[model samples]
Target chain A: MNTYTNRQWIYSKRPENVVDERHYSLQTTSLSTTELKENQVVLKSKYFSLDPYMRIQQSALETWERPHPLDTVQGGAVVGQIQDIHPSCREFEVGDWVLSYTGWQEYAIADVSGLRKLNRDEVPLTTALGILGMPARVAYFGLQDVGQPKPGETVVVSGASGAVGQIVTQIAKIKGCHVIGIAGSDEKTKYLKETLQLDGVINYKKFTTQKEIHLELKRLAPQGVDIYYDNVGGYITDAVIDSINTYARIIICGQISQYSDGLDTPNLGPRFLHKMLYKRAKIQGVLARDYNNRMPELLEEMTPWVQQGLLHYKETIVNGFENLPKALNMLFYGKNTGKLIVEV
Target chain B: MNTYTNRQWIYSKRPENVVDERHYSLQTTSLSTTELKENQVVLKSKYFSLDPYMRIQQSALETWERPHPLDTVQGGAVVGQIQDIHPSCREFEVGDWVLSYTGWQEYAIADVSGLRKLNRDEVPLTTALGILGMPARVAYFGLQDVGQPKPGETVVVSGASGAVGQIVTQIAKIKGCHVIGIAGSDEKTKYLKETLQLDGVINYKKFTTQKEIHLELKRLAPQGVDIYYDNVGGYITDAVIDSINTYARIIICGQISQYSDGLDTPNLGPRFLHKMLYKRAKIQGVLARDYNNRMPELLEEMTPWVQQGLLHYKETIVNGFENLPKALNMLFYGKNTGKLIVEV
Candidate 1:
């Protein structure tokens, strides 16, 4: 075996205010010369994905303020190549490209269960994390199964330029829903409408209030929205709920507003459930990882849409593992336009 | 020509506040012998069942508050005997017993489209409204389908002494779940435990806080409540949500607290969505009228249970059509246990 070194980022300490250079410290460790276990493979990570969910894990100790924790190497997805595989690890060959939950690392030991052989080489490897992997899968099933958008019905997606929201908008469009998107910037609003073909885009920064929401939504979708894919569950959700058509469905895929800033803080937006009951609406909470059998079903459905040029995905990739925090910070601040990933 | 008289309560005007005798006025209306139209029948009401949903219909001007129209006599279930039938109405023969939405009246002109001919006479006529009709059917479907209780689960039913709650508590018990009921009084609590066989009971008026809730639930269930059948959607719902186990389901069949109360009044307690999301729970809002096809199925399933001494119903009957407003008031005030009805 060739001599090698594996540099990894381990969980240093739980984050308090914000994740910076200190919250996660870079530690370089030597590769073990010990015999490889069966069904294990040594892989070289080519790219790593940074996401807001990690910030949730970083602040796990914040008492319902943050999400749960992972005790091992900070978990994330990586596009990697199989360097070597033990005899028991079948179906993978040396040099085969694979995606694994290897986190922010240069090279890592991957368990077979966490690895998937990448297909469709022309599509950028980074798309695996955004439009093809977890976030995209979330948007795919969340809108279809949970939101249950009907053709020609009005559909609204918050965080439109983010990995999940972008795909959700495009998917709704393909299904013949009148799609409206909400983002925080002019460029994202333009991208959502011009590039992704959304019917309307609302910059939440430019306007707020139930009245403004009513007027804008009426102009864009006069019939009223039937399905709301809620990525940022705060006042925006409240506004959207206020404008919902009867028996509307809401997919609570994430509460980016609360999850990013932390939950226990006084900055969190007020709760919204009365609106849910008033409209006789449904709100479903979900994660991409929870879509086990659904993941491949969605991937199969989306592959054709992407191939037919109906679906598009954009990635904002940062170079080097040291920028992992920066790439993830983009997610928290809503700075990154699509899926945020890091190349090592 | 035969003459008929109906001593009925009419909705005098749109309800400006919680409905009382002021919103209604008792008047005697004489009916001239008018010929029954096609698909119509003439019926004399034996019992008019008063329900919590009457409150929802009384406040229709509130935008979301869907109130029944003024002077429509306000619709609800009535057990009646068909006095005459038109040539086209073959489903019900003259002198056959039937259940219909005949409103607050001694006599009703029923559209055959909206009436159910009673098949099983083994049970009392009042059960047609209280347990075997809309309320009981709502309880059965809401708990079985929406609440989705499993064996060994714990179910918490708010308004546990009311028409729907009594049936839900018993059904949960039949499904092998430990049931905790929230009623307003000790006598009703006794009815819940001794008659309805609920595992535990709480007078939500007395105990407060998650601490008291946790203590009672811990002692009774220890395993945590797995399903919440919420009828009174206010403080009691808050307590039930606090005691729910992960992945628990809440059936939002009625918000008795919100009906006819002014929009801005203090009807809300704790917002339920956060706990719903964190617990991966499901909350379903239901109306029994939407489940008409299932009525025959429900009657078939529940009749045996009622006849074999497994299922039972409680009726709080107010004598005479003059007492319709008072019976309705009793529902709003929580003064009547189980279904409140007026014998017309």
Candidate 2:
């Protein structure tokens, strides 16, 4: 039997604001190669998905469901290589690449039931944690079923350069809708406009006041926003909502801006209630996990777009297992341009 | 030709905060028996529905569309007597009772195209302005379609003693839901519990802190609220949202709490966005006018409930056209238990 040293991040305490090292303790542990249980696989982490949703998990809000026990490893989507598999695990081989919602650790003994085998050669294996995985699925399912972007309609996406937002913007464009991307940085706006060919772009960081954001939104969506894909909820969502057309659809997948602030986060605004009524808008929150049953359908629709050069993906990789805390914080500071990941 | 003096409430100016006399001018106008124009009928107001929606008309907010001209008669739903009809109008005759958005006036030269003929004997003529009219239809359509209350689902209604709220409570009860009603006054909660037979009642005015309201809601909706019929959007809504269950449906028919305060109204609080996401809830704003196409269908379904004495309708009538402003203001102060109307 072979023994190996494994580095793991354990939840220490709930975060008060933005997460830091104080919220977690990285400890070196040892694991010995042992006989695998039936239908179980040994997973060696290749890449850890750094997402704003990770910040939600560290928060103390009761609404933030703890999928794992406290003081256990902090959990995230991990693209891993199967090290050893039980004889009963027929779906996966020892060398097969896969994705699992395994916690932040160098190695994990995971049930095959939660593992999805990945075809690494077709695209980057890290995409199993990103574009071809959670983010793309969220973009496809939320926009198709929730936003329902239609031809000639105006669609505004906040966090427009983030993993899910970028995909949502492209999908809206592919559907023939006029896409307006709202990103925090000029570089992000440029990427969305120059690379993605979004119909319009708003650099939200350039706006100082709510009125400024509202004016910019009105300028970009002259016919009014028919669909809003909300990745960041705060003043950006407030401004987009202000310009919504009749029977508009608002797909609320994330509120990254408020994740750190928790329940004390201010609402979109006071007029949000009235604006909703007058516009007769529909606002719904979507969880990609809930739509995993339709992942094959999502892959069918989105894979062609990527292969044909219609969809482009971006990655912001932070190297090493030790950089996990800093990588997670990058999401809060808007330092990451697209999908943020930590390579182990 | 006979001439008569008629009093009319005209929109004088936009309200600064809550609507007041400065926003309206009671004018003594004159109407004469003259040959009617094509599609024009002379209407004598019998009962005027002075609703919270009228306050929206007086507000300076641009989103609240003024369907009628300002400095003219203040528009509202009115139950009227057809004193004379244009010869070209074959659908209505003199002495017919009908419902029309004829504004706050004793007489209006209305277009026959906008009138809905009413059977005065089938129900109280004023019921055409209350239960059997817009309020009831709003309750029927919004609850049935938007809320989608399932049997045994926990349903909560804010402003539960108001026109539409009371009806929504009854319909939710009939649908076999565990009904919880929240109102501004204790009397309102008592009526909802004793007369309406609601499963639970929360007197919102009794709670000084949001925590108190939240605790009470937790006690009442032990399993969490599945359906929320939002008639008032303020702290009460914040409390209801706090207790919402997964896949909750929020039917946003009215936000009477903020109609007076306009855009300055405080939000349902910061936690609302996260709660919606965690619960995968649906929040939709509904206008009864949008459901007019389904009016006959709604009436068909609800009429039987009313006839069988399964649904009880209540009205707060303020006699005379001079009291129009007073009657409309009652809705803002939570003075009216049910539908607020002015008998002209």
The lDDT of each candidate is 0.76, 0.83
| Per-residue alpha-carbon lDDT of candidate 1 for residues A73-124, written as tens digits (9 for 90 to 100) | 6778889988878888778888888889877778777787778888746566
| Model 1: fnat (fraction of native contacts) | 0.16
DockQ, structure candidate 1: 0.25
Per-residue C-alpha lDDT of model 2 across residues B69-116, encoded as one tens digit per residue: 578888888888988777888888899888999788898888988988
Identify the candidate with maximal lDDT: 2
lDDT of 2 at A114: 95
TM-score for all predictions? Answer: 0.89, 0.97
Output the lDDT of residue B32, model 2. 78
Which 10 consecutive residues of model 2 chain A have the lowest summed lDDT?
A262-271
Residues A1-344 of candidate 2 have per-residue lDDT tens digits of: 55668899997777768887777899998876674678988889989998877776665555547533568898889999988777887888989999998879999889999988888667779777777889988889999998877799999999999989988988888899999999999899999999999989999989987679989889877788899999888877877877888899998899988878754444444447767877788989998888999999888876777667778989999999998887888898889887999997
CAPRI-style class, candidate 2: medium
Clashing pairs in 2: none
